[model samples]
Target: MKGQLILLDHLTGPDGPVEAAALMRDGRLEDLFIDSDAPRPGAIYRAKADRPVKGQGGMFLTTPDGPAFLRQVKGLSPGAPLLVQVTGHAEPGKAIPVTTKLLFKSRYAIVTPGAPGINVSRQIKDDETRDALLEIAHDTLDGHPIHDHEGGLILRSSCAEAEGDAVAEDIAAMADLAVQVLNDAEGEAEKLTEGDGPHAMAWREWVTPAQIETEAGCFAHHGVHEKIEALFRPEVALGSATVFIEPTRAFTAVDVNTGADTSLAAGLKANLALARDLPRQLRLRGLGGVVILDLAPMPKKDRRSFEGALRAALKTDDTDTVMAGWTPLGNYELQRKRARQPLTDIVTEEMLQ
Candidate 1:
């Protein structure tokens, strides 16, 4: 199986989410998750410029979707309506990232709101496949043109494998959504206060209902928050290996060990097995930034082999991760870039209150 789907549910208040986190894991593979409460990477919003920071970080703007820090400095003025799309989600103390170059996401393509041309994802790579998808997208949109619509199509990498009918359907659907978004922004007169955007989970409100029906043995659990809380424990054991996951102010450290009576071969095997769960745990726990791995000691000649094995295990991690190599203290250092609060921290906050 590619992955085991773990349904995530959120506890919510009247306005929106109080908690939402989803986890997906398969045998010895990296885990996948969806942080519903966090700002989505592709959703668009119509924001009004607040005030420029004068060569500082960026411009602050308010929108119904969320408050975003716009990096476009020049020609931006206060109280003007501007359409933007979220480029990144929020972190503990920082605002979410956004851009004026808005784009709408689809299963096979991205629909740019006001642009006039189609382009394919550079990662699609093969010239012939890229050209075929481009032709299909342009032809589909041409036959189904909405009058004076500003919709433009850009094929996603996955479209390289998508059937022609699927591509056409997605293009039409995304273009329709884009048009609706543009239509709404013109009439939107809402203003933002500090509390408005931080808690809403927009994706949940928009998810396709068929998604839950399609996955076998993976239905939304009645107690999603409870499941999330259960997995938030600091340590967990798998087979002969016990993992110690501790998050400090600086970084999160994951240590792997076998019971004391084990021989070197057993311990090494345990370490290799633990490698599969390491990336899975990081993602499930929403651990990001610098991470340290402390595995049981191995032969000097085997260090390279262990690192390669660990790399193979982490190849499925969707978040961009880079191995910073080993540290002087005999721990392996890695970096994963993502923005969100850890589930452990979330638990702590609830416990405190």
Candidate 2:
């Protein structure tokens, strides 16, 4: 455990350089991040409202990068310039999904404009630590002209282990950036902030102390390439059971199989195992959207335990996911946010070739 490693490297493709990060635990690839040129989910932009779709309750907006779609356009008029943040990766040839609510997130704090309140992450259960972080947040933001007090600060769980000065600096820096970007909103369709790359993201999100590797070809040295390539295939072996994850044009399909296990509880065991690993599988593949899970033939009575395991797994995952319950045919469904570019789509075919 002390020897866990985070490897950061770059891969060249037809599009240009793609930044990559891989987390290795006990000599196995545990997580991965690959950058893409597509519009990132957290990027903020000053966009001009385009024509509203007559049928859909959303309107298309023009950003410097490309067209973006924003829902609930009741107050926005055509040609009006407003701030928006990219909400998710767009489907092929579709407008990038965006929202008017902007959030500036950093390693230690999240600054929310138009939502004023100083809140601390619930993960820090220590009363003394929470009070200390709240005091730091107030000290950093007390007199700052952040959106005329409409800006709120959220001290992230990372602050628990971080130095007070560092946490305060992160909060102050994000608050200042939010104010600056908001003040500069009276302009053409322009990107206010570029999304963080893989290396930066690894630094921010992978807060657990680990051996960091930045040498070139580190991915190849650590066998990350092979692990990633294996994901191109559908089957992932979990002990004697296997989980198959295949993405389609509309949704991702997941199937659980109990390999040669003839025990009565084989189906229930496989389903529970897949439920724990499903989040990591989807996250590494960067596949999101509708997820249809076809679990092995488990007794209906065991569905509650299966759901509990799945919910617990997803609760710890960073991605937003909602379990939509079981279908008539005993299949389960999940709706996951498209927070990253799909691994297959981002890795160029030529590179694989």
Strongest candidate by lDDT: 2
**What lDDT score goes with residue 108 in model 2?**
94
Name the 10 consecutive residues with the lowest summed lDDT in model 1. 191-200
Query: Compared with the true structure, what per-residue lDDT tens digits does model 2 show for residues 135-220?
Result: 89888888899949499988888889999999989998899999998898898889989988889888888887799989989887
**Superposed Cα deviation of residue 189, candidate 2 (Å):** 1.1
Model 1 root mean square deviation, Cα atoms = 6.1
The TM-score of candidate 1 is 0.68
Q: Which candidate is the best by TM-score?
A: 2
The C-alpha lDDT values of all candidates are 0.63, 0.89
TM-score of every prediction relative to native? 0.68, 0.96
Off by over 4 Å in 1: 1-41, 52-57, 64-67, 71-81, 112-132, 143-154, 157-163, 179-230, 265-271, 339-341, 344-353
What is the per-residue lDDT of model 1 for residues 179-227, given as tens digits with 9 covering 90 to 100?
A: 6666666545342122112213222222222222123223233333444
